[model samples]
Every structure is written in C-alpha cells, then in structure tokens.
Target: MISVPVSLVVVVPMCASLLIAVLGLTKYRCHWHISIVATFVSFIASLALLYNTLQIGRISYWLGGWEPPWGIEYVIDYYSGFVLVAITLVSLLTTVYAATYVKREVGESRDLSFAILNMLMVTGLHGIIVTGDLFNLYIFLEITSIAAYSLIGAGKKKGALVASFNYLILGTIGAIFVLIGVAYLYMITGTLNMADLRAILPVHYDSKVVFAAFAFITVGLAIKFALFPLHTWLLSAHSLAPAVVCSVLAASILKVTAYALIRVMFTVFEAGFTLEVIPATEILLVMSIIAIIVGGILTAAQTNLKRMLACSSLGQMGYIVLGVAIADQMAMTGSILHLLNHSLMKGGLFLIAGAIIHKVRIYDIADMKGVGRKMPLTMAAFTIIGLSMVGVPLTVGFVSKWHIAVGALKAGMWYIIPVIVASSLLTAFYFGRVIRNAYFASEGSDQGSSSKAHDHAHNQHGDRNSESRSEAPPGMVIPILIFAGLCIILGTAAFIPVSIAEKAAIMLLEGT
Candidate 1:
C-alpha cells in the first residue's frame, strides 16, 4: 500500500491557488493549466488514500505533530476515503472541461479569477472530507461557500448576480447554524475532535443542549444540501451559474455537504440518538418523501434546460436522504453509491447543457428541435445519462435505486417503495421530454425547422450549414463523454463502488 499524507489532497490545490493568484498579477494566462495539474495531483493522492484505507482500516493525520483533542486531526475511514475519490475525480474533470467552456461564457479577462476561485473551492472541499475537528469542518465549509458565491457572482449570465446574492444569504444562514452547533458541542464536550465527540456525547444524548446542537447542525446542512423546503436558493444558483460551476456544484459540492450530514448523524452521534432519541430519522423520511415528489413536479414545470436539470437535483437529493432515513446498512450503501453515480450523471448532464449552449446558443427546451442531428455525439451522451437519471436497468442509477428499494423493504417501510416508483416515473416524464425533443421531434414541426435551427446556430458560430455538426471544443466534449461512459461502465461493474460502500455502511452502522 502507498504511504501518503492525508493532507496532500487538500494542500496541493491550495498551493496552486496561491500560485495562480501570484501569476495573475504578472499576466500569466496559463491558470487553467495549473488548476488541472493541481487537481490531477489531488486525485492521485485521493486514490492512494482510498487504497490505503481499504487495506488498512482507518487512517488519521495530525497537524503540527500534536495528538488529537489538543490539535487538529484529519481522519479517513471507508466513508471519507470514498468521498475524497469522488470529489477529486469530478473536480479534475470539471477543470478540464472548464478550460474551454469558461472562455466562451466568462471571457478571458476573468479566467484567472475563475481558476483561483475554483482551486480554493476545491481546497475547501478536500478539507471538509478529511478534517476530524468540528470547528475545522465549519471553517472549511465557509471557505467553500464563499468561493462558490464569488464564482457564481462572476458569471456573465443575466441573473447570475441575483442568483449569487440569494445563495449567499441562504448559505450564510446555514453556515451560522453550523457554527452555533459546533460551539454548542464544544461548550459541552470540551473537545472539537469528532472522535472525542463520539466517545463523549452518548452520556449526554438526552440532554437538551445535545438535542439542540443536533437540530441546529442537521437543519444547517439540510439547507446547504438543498433538502426540500430549504431548497429555494438552488434552482437560481445552479441554473444561472457558469456551466463548469454548475457541474461542480451539482456533482461535488452538494454531495460533500450531504456526506457531512451523514457523518454527523451516524458517526458523531450514535444511531440510537438519531433514530430513536430525537426522531431524526422519521423527520428526515417525511422531508425526503416530500422533496422527491415536489422536486419532480417542479422539474417538469421548467422550460429552460439548465433549470430542469437543477430541479431534478432536488429530487435526487431526496433519494440520498431517503437512504439515510432508512438507516439500514443496505440503505446507507445505496445512498453512498448514488452519491458517486449522481455526480457522474448530473455533472455530465450540466456539461452537455453547457456544450449545447456554447455550440448553438440554445437554452430553452422548446428551442432544441433537431439538436440531436446538430450535435449527435453530445446528444448521444445526453441520452445515456438522461436514461441513467431515470433509473433504467443496467445503469448506475438503477443499481442505487434498486438497493434503496430493497433497503426500504428490509426496513419494513414497504410504502417507501411506491415513493421510489413514483419518483422514477416522474424522472422518466421529465428526462423523456428532453430525449424525445432532441431525437424524435420533427425538424420542421411547429417548434422550428432544421434550417431555422441553423439560423439560431448562426448567431453563435456564424453561418453553419444545416448538415454541419456543432460540438463543443474537444476539451469539453471529452470530459462529458468520459462522464457518460463511466455511467455505463460503473453500472455494469457495480461491484467496485458497492464493495466500498458496503464496507462503509457496515462500519457506520456498527459505529466502528
């Protein structure tokens, strides 16, 4: 097994951010190059860490060579290690895709800032994954949130400024709640280390202070992850941000936030506290069901393609939360698997959306007639990914959904099965709209003709013939295709992620 510092994954990108900032002052225009290399290094380190964690049970690193409870700690078990891999892999691809897409959307003047903010955001996310100190986690969370706000606010889109402002207000409230929860826990336990908190909190599980802390933390994270009623800010932020930003936000940022919630519920506090002492599981179950239904209905109501995908993410978040509420090993495994699968699926979808917009300047679904012929390869990838989103069999989405369904049955919540079915139908209803419009809609129907579509394309790239292809640059298209391919490859080779997720679920349930 390889021996590497757990902090390596966080540090590399951080250093690169600093380097980019310095270079930006001197007119160096290779910020994307540095961002890609930093993310690649982080991805490699994450893989090594995952391999080591699987071979050895758990890994921990201490900052400043001090022991835990007295100094900061970074811990990686099955769960964090798996999450590290997912975040870094997607972040790496997003960086690659952004190299070309950012130029088209945000222009060259802001590329330096984009690269710097992107790296900083990545640094914060990696910090969140590895940190074992509650206060440190909160710190990392703020770093991530602030960087995200800047990235979104810097977008050239019409509503980008408004979207960023909404996200900032909501995101700050969530961060404050999390900070308060951390302070409350520290006041009681006198330790910021998560391991120590787990060891100490059980005796005070029935205390009102402990209950309040749990409530505060969970609600804050719910907002951060855009769960149901707290999700008002997600659609605008996701839909209006730059495509690369959308890809990272949908794929990595939200998943890690959900991971934090799971860690707090299952690791810091015992299962009994979450499931019985506080009725947390039951509450989550109700919220998740509502989110799944409402999110789907809203998704189908959207006219813009990016808005539709953003709405669908709300429903997808519901699936992950459902698995958590089930609180069974299989359910947890499904939740974790879906985290990885959804990252690949939604990330690719957003990239495709960006590609379409970049190539043809079409964002509204009604304007997408004959897009399939105009961008056949891109649309093909979209079709596969869209199908995966609908939980079609032999795709990664179906595997995770199947596990969640079985988990529901195993937990004797047979009613949840129908919720899953209903969500799937809703998913098909929405995604199928795009699929049909892209591939089967008559080119000369009332929507628009192939020639007219070319006229629309003319605005972007200047006078393309009806028969010409309008794929995004190779840098962007390659990553989108890679994400789509992984959806199928990982679906068929389900054992890879399942084995890791199964182990993580077991450890989480057993409180190891």
Candidate 2:
C-alpha cells in the first residue's frame, strides 16, 4: 500500500494561521474564510491518514529522516487515526459554525487573532494525536492549553478574563505534572518514544519512581479531563466563553485529554499495568462514576442553559473514561466510539446554544420559552442532540451506551449497567427541563431569569431579525443541522465507528 504523509494534518492548519496573520488579520471578513479553508484541508488530511492506516495497519513516520529512539515519530495507528478524524472533522465544522459567530462575538477588528488562535488550537490537538514522543505530547498539550486560554478570555463577557485565568492556573499545573512524569520516565528508561518506553518500562513498574510517575500523570490528566471534583474550572470556562470557543472546548478539548491518557495507559505503559498490576484503572473507575453522578446532579440544578450543558459535559466524559477503565474489548470499543459520538453530539448542542444566545440573547432555560418558536431549526437540532444525550434509541448516544452496557455485563460488572441507565435518565431530566422551557413554559411571566445568568447583549444587532421567525445565521445553522443528522446516521449505522474502535481496542489489548 502507498504511504500517506501524516504531518499534513498539522501543517495545513498551522500554515493557515500564518496566512491569516499575514493577510486575513487586517481584513475581518477574510478570517472566517481562511479558517474554514484551512480546517477543511486539515480534515481532508486526517481522512487520508485514517484511510492509509486502516489499509497498512500501524504506520510510524520518523521526523527529519531520523529513525525511532533517536528522533520524534508520528504514529498512525487505529486509535490515533480514529481520534484524528474526529478532531479534525469537528474542528472543521466548528469553523463553519464560527463563520457568522466571530463577527458578532469577537467583532471585526479581532477576527484575525481569533482565527489564528482557533487554528493553532486545532493544530495542537492534531499534534497530540500523532506524536509518538512523550515530551512532544506535553509540548502539544501546552500549545492547545495556551490557545484555549486566550480564546476563552477574548469574549466580551464580564468574567471571561477571570474564567480564563482560573483555567490557565489549573491547566498550567496539570501540564507541569505531565512534564514531571515525562521526566521521571525518561530518567529511568532513557527514552521518550512511546513504543520504546513501553518496551523498557516493565521491570520498573513496581518501583516507587515508576508509581510516582504514574500518579503524577494520572492526576494531571484527571484535572484536564475534569473528572468530578477536579472539574471546578470546566463549568465556568465552558459557560462563559464565546459560542465558537465553547463548542470547540466542550466538544473537542476534554476528549483529546482523555485520548492522551489512553495513549499513556495503553500505549506507553501496558494495558495490564493500568488495569491489573496497579490501582490506576480502579481509581479511574470510581472517579468516572462520581463524575457521572455529580455532573448529572449539577446539570439538573443549573438554571443557566450553558452551565447546564457544560456540567453535562463532565458527566458525558465519565462515560468515556468508564469504558476505558472497563478495559474489556466491547467496553473499550464503546469508550473510543463515545469520544466521537460525544464530539458530534455536544458540538451540535453547543452550537445550537450559541445560536440561541446569538439570536435571542438569553441563557436561562426559563427565558427560552417560546424562543424555540423563534428558532425552530436551531431548537430542532438541540432537541435531537438532547435526546441522544439521554441515550434514546436510533441515536449515536444510544449505540455507545449499549455497547458499554453489554461490555459491562461481559466483564461481570453487570451492576454498573443500571448506573449507566440511571445516568441517562439524569441527562434526560436536565435536558427535559430545557425542552419544556423552550416548547411549553410561558415566556411572558419570566423576567430575563437572572441578571447574572446571561451575557446580556444590548440592542440586539445583525444576527437577529426584527420580523417573525428569527433563526441563527445560515452558516451556524448548517453545521448544527449536519451534526443533528449525523446523530441519527451514526446511531443507525454505527458499524463504521464500532469497527474502527474495535480494531484500536484489539491492538491495545494485543500489546498488553
């Protein structure tokens, strides 16, 4: 089979950011155009990488004509390939969603900066997915984090700066933990290549140094993943950011952090080490449960629509980690597939929320009453994603949960199945509140819900229509509708993601 160069996935977006700096910054209208084109190209490259990986199995490309153990390599295996496609595809769609949004949220003058940060953020994500070196992963992780910090703060909201700073502090500490872990591993094994470390780290697994490294890495990732107690920064950061920023962070960033953990647990160290030999998997399992329960409860309690969805994201992330903690074949497949499913699901939901904010300027669920009537198409997209999050059948969410349930049973952890079902109900409960508010609750009596709950836009500008039937701009609406369609399409025919996830799981298991 012919080889496909994987670096283009990163190059396309990176170059676009550079181009935007040179030409698009001065011209605000050009930012969205550059972003869309650049992200689309990266998406195409990711597709190529996925196709080539499936045909040839694992493909490791050495950088600068240097071989492994001496140079950084980009490994395109089933796991990385699957993640690459999902990240780039969502990144691309986000640009489509952002086309009209950036104009309103960031304004015309700063459009280029927003576009550059956005592109760089995605470039960092792709780098994390493809890099085979441990230290390289940390660098990419920082790149993504820094870009995210800037993007979150760029919004004109009152606390946007505070939220961004809180995230920067927490995220910087997490990055430090990860860096320390990388250094510890290198000290003993004298290698940074994941494959090389995996080959060399066995005897050291029982040593205190090795265990400390594991602890540091796991703690860092847990913070990044925002698993329950560690999620202090997630809700505000996601809820306060601009629409485009919120969608990308909610739909993509956390998932990639989990993917990085998957790499460390399954690729660099050994699957057996995580699950059987150490307490890591067990701790992950408990944390995953707490994340689900707490996130769901908080989501139900939230009065603000964005905070509710942001909290809900914490719970959904629990499902991904839960599947991996199960570490069984079917469960692992479900876990990996959930990453993709949730990205599409949450991406659609957040974009619709963005649209709601864009057109109606309301964030409270109660204020959304009759708002759906104003934005039928956007609300319809929101409904589809909401039901999916509730694990309704014939949706991608159901497919993922189904596999995980069966995987739980097959692993003799049958009791957890009820917990999964219950979590779905909790999801439905909160989303149901929104649906009722949007469709049934009377909006006339409500007085803007709460002053602190929303961004409170003034004089409602270009994105809104004065006449009857105002909806989000066409650019934003199109991406939401496409993702909504995908929720059904992927759920009904989940064979594609399931098959790829299964292959990735198999490869990881075999390595163990």
Candidate 3:
C-alpha cells in the first residue's frame, strides 16, 4: 500500500525517449532539452525518494494494484535509492555532453540516434534499479543491452562495428545464461517476485534445482559484469564507441551488472544453498586479484587514450569484486562506495577524453603532448580526473580506496594490502604517462611527420584561425566542467557521500 511515485520517476523519461524515437532523428529539434530535463526530473524524484526513506522507511509500489507475493512491484531502499541518484546524475550529464559531441562525432542524423539510444539506456537502468521481480530484471537487462549495442555500433569507425558485433555475440550469451538461470529459479520456486523468492529460497536449500540456479545466476551475472575472462568485448567496445557512449556504459551499466551480481549473491542467496555449500568467496577473491593485476598491467601497455582508460576500468571492477570477495562488512561497504566513486571518476575522465577528441580530432596518447597547455581548462579537468584515478587525497577516489584498505585490514587479508599498493602504483604509472604527455612532453616533429592514414582530415590545419575555432562547443564544454566541478565538490563534501554509502552498505550487509 506504499504510495510512492516510483512509476512516474521511471516512466516519464522513458515515455519521452520513446516519443523522441517516433519523432524521427532530424525533425526533433529540442532533443537535448527534452533528454536533459527528463533526467533532471528523474534525479529530483530520486532525491525525494531518498528523503522519504530516511523520514519514513522502505518504499514499495505495486503495479496495477497487485500485491507483492504474486504481482510485480517496485521497491526502493537505501541502496537502490542511492544508485538511482548516481545513475540519474551521470545519465543527465552524459546527455548534456552528447548534445554537441554527438553532432561532431557523427552527423546530425546520428545525433538523433544517439539521443534515442541514451534515453533507452537510462530507461533500462531505471528499470533495473526499480523492478522487484527477477524476470523483470532480465527484461530490463535486455532493454539496456540492446540499446548499448546499438549505441556502440553508432560509431563511424569500422572498429566500432566489429566491437559492437562482438559485444552483441557475448552480450547475447550472457543474457541467455541469465535467462536460463531465472527460468531454473522460477521452476523451483514457483514465483517470480524477488521478495517472495528470497523468502522461499532458503527453505529449499537442499534441492538440486536451487543449486543449479545459484550456479547459473553467479556465472551468468559475472559474464554480464565483464569480470576478468569475459571482458574481451568491453575493452574494444569502450575504446571505439562514441565518447558519450563510453561514459554511460562505463559509468553506469557495467556497475549495474556488478550491483545485480552483489544483490543476488548477498540478498537472495546469502541465506541460500550457495553460500553454505560452496567456497564462493574464495573463488571471487582469486578471480578479483587476477583481474586487478592483469587489468592494471594491460592498462599500462595501451598507447591509445581510450583503450588505456577502458583497460583501467577492468582494474576498478576487480577492486569492487575484491571487496565482495573479501566478504567482510567493511570490505563490502568499501566495494559499494567504490562503485559510486569509480563511476564519477571514470565518467569524468571519459568526458574529458571526448572533449580532447572533439577539439583535436586525435586519439593517440603521444598526440596529446603539451596540448594540455593549449586546452588548459580541459586538461586541468583531465588532471583532476587523473589524480582521482590514482586515489590522490581530497578526491572522491581517495575516499573509496581508504575504505577499501580498511576493509582489507578488517578481513585480515593483509596480503591484499600489497596488491592494493601495487595496483595503486600501476595506476599512477600509466596515468602518470598520460599526465606527462599532456603537460610536459614536446609537441615534437610528429606534428606534420605523422604516418596515420587518417591524418588527411587534418591536413588543412595550416589555417590557424579555423583550427583555433575548432575547440569544443559550449554544450560539450559545460557538461565537462559540471562533472569536473562535481568531482571537486563531492570530494570536499565528503560526509554526504560517506553517510549515504554507509547507509546503503549497511542495508546490503544486514539486509533490509
């Protein structure tokens, strides 16, 4: 009987998205205004939900007046509410960013396509966070995945198509695995509602079907999350896709998969057969360590800015998984906080990358040398982001790492301290390279001595006035500054995030 306005929170933006799609790409003049306003409204609604949760209690809404044990429901607690805020903020910022960048990256026709894709992407994200049914989660997952595949393919680069194709193949496989798991779960439990299933699952712990369902959910969710080995499609897809696409996918969707994985592991299966019967924690721990080491090392090796950042994402995911793997209250708390922090840092970094790409039309790390001096504001923003990635103090990244370190200590996994230290160093090393190139490295003879076949487009750089005018447009620059400003503001307003993350973390640990 909870009368929360959950439906309006998710539906309004989604309806607008669909409307934009129907209006067609060309004629829709105010797509930016529409998208930005929709997300902003959603963000405000989420904040209201957060306030209501603190003042009241959990919020649940039944669809069509159907009760929870039988019909679909929308549930929001501390955790879901916090994530809703993060998703909305990032989606809003990225939409603002895409307004100008999309036109520059692709044509105006494709700009509309980007807008439509973004709207659906946010809808899918909102759907995942709000749904109370297991099958509904799968449905939302598909919606998000399909939109993501289309966006990745929206890139003009040939590599974008190949990346999207591979992601399509792998994403389909992951979704199938999840669907199969959901089916097995339903077959055994005879219910699709998550709350009902959670309550009923523990009673059937000894059944083979339930165990199979556990395996399916764990493995399937891992694949969708791009945990280690299943991450092949992620690097290239993130590297080649339009910058706006990368920012959204990296900042939110992948994290959502991890969020789902944790929700299933902790909330649904924490008391089920899986935790008691298997060494799931140890397995997650080992894989996480491998991912951390491998992702960091590989990040150091990439020459392209996008690919390097993409590989770095794998490392950050590993850290989150590591926290879950450690399975201590503090570690889990750190993991959850890191999830939000990583989204901000990575999203900001990618946005700046987009700015660089828009202004210079280049992707190589070498080409970025001393260009920071030219694009001081953009590079300054990039520097803050880069420092955050390295977990520098007074940045949001540091806050997460500090919690993670404490968590590692609490778990008595002192060995992980070294891994954390080493990975931090590796992060510094690779990010440092980018910093050096951006600020100090010489412009060099490479200006006109380029061998890239794509340099033909810039052959007209002889006209200095036109080249200077090529800086990123206002829509692009404004969002970048906004995100960069957020990095500083959030970093300074440390208690706000700490309190929210702590509340969400406590919810996950103790289970509402």
Top-lDDT structure, candidate number: 1
Hey, what RMSD does candidate 3 come out at?
A: 4.6
Better of 2 and 3 by TM-score: 2
Summarize candidate 1's per-residue lDDT along 1-512 as a digit string, tens digits. 89899989889999999999998888556799999999999999999999999998899999889999899999989999998998999999999999888877888888788999999999999999999999999999999999999999876676999999999999999989998998899889999899999999998887888989999999999999999999999999999999889999999889999999999998899887898888899999999999999999999899899999999999999999999999988988999999999999999999999999999988988778678878999999999999899999879999999999999999999999989999899999888888767765644455533344544544333223356778888999999999999999999999999999999999888887
**In candidate 2, which residue ranges exceed 4 Å CA deviation?**
1-3, 24-29, 445-467
Residue ranges of candidate 1 with Cα displaced over 4 Å = 448-465
Task: List the global CA lDDT of all models.
Answer: 0.91, 0.86, 0.81
Residue 120, model 3: lDDT of 86
Candidate 1 residue pairs in backbone clash = none
Tell me the TM-score of model 3: 0.93
Q: Which TM-score value belongs to model 1?
A: 0.96
**Best-to-worst ranking by lDDT:** 1, 2, 3
Evaluate residue 338 in candidate 2 and report its C-alpha lDDT on the 0 to 100 scale.
Answer: 93
- The positional error of residue 487 in candidate 1, measured at the CA in angstroms, is 0.4
Model 2, 1-512: lDDT tens digits are 54568788877888888888888535444767888988888888778888888897888888887999899999999999999899998999999888788888678777778888998999898899999999999999999999999999987787989999999999999999999999899999999999999999998988888888888988898788788889999989999999789889988899899999988989898888888788887888888988888888889899888888888999899999999888889999999999999999988888888899888898888777677677888988888999999999999999889988898899999878878978988998888878866754444435434342232332133124423689878998999999999999989888888899999999887782
Candidate 3 stretches greater than 4 Å from native? 1-4, 25-28, 271-275, 445-471
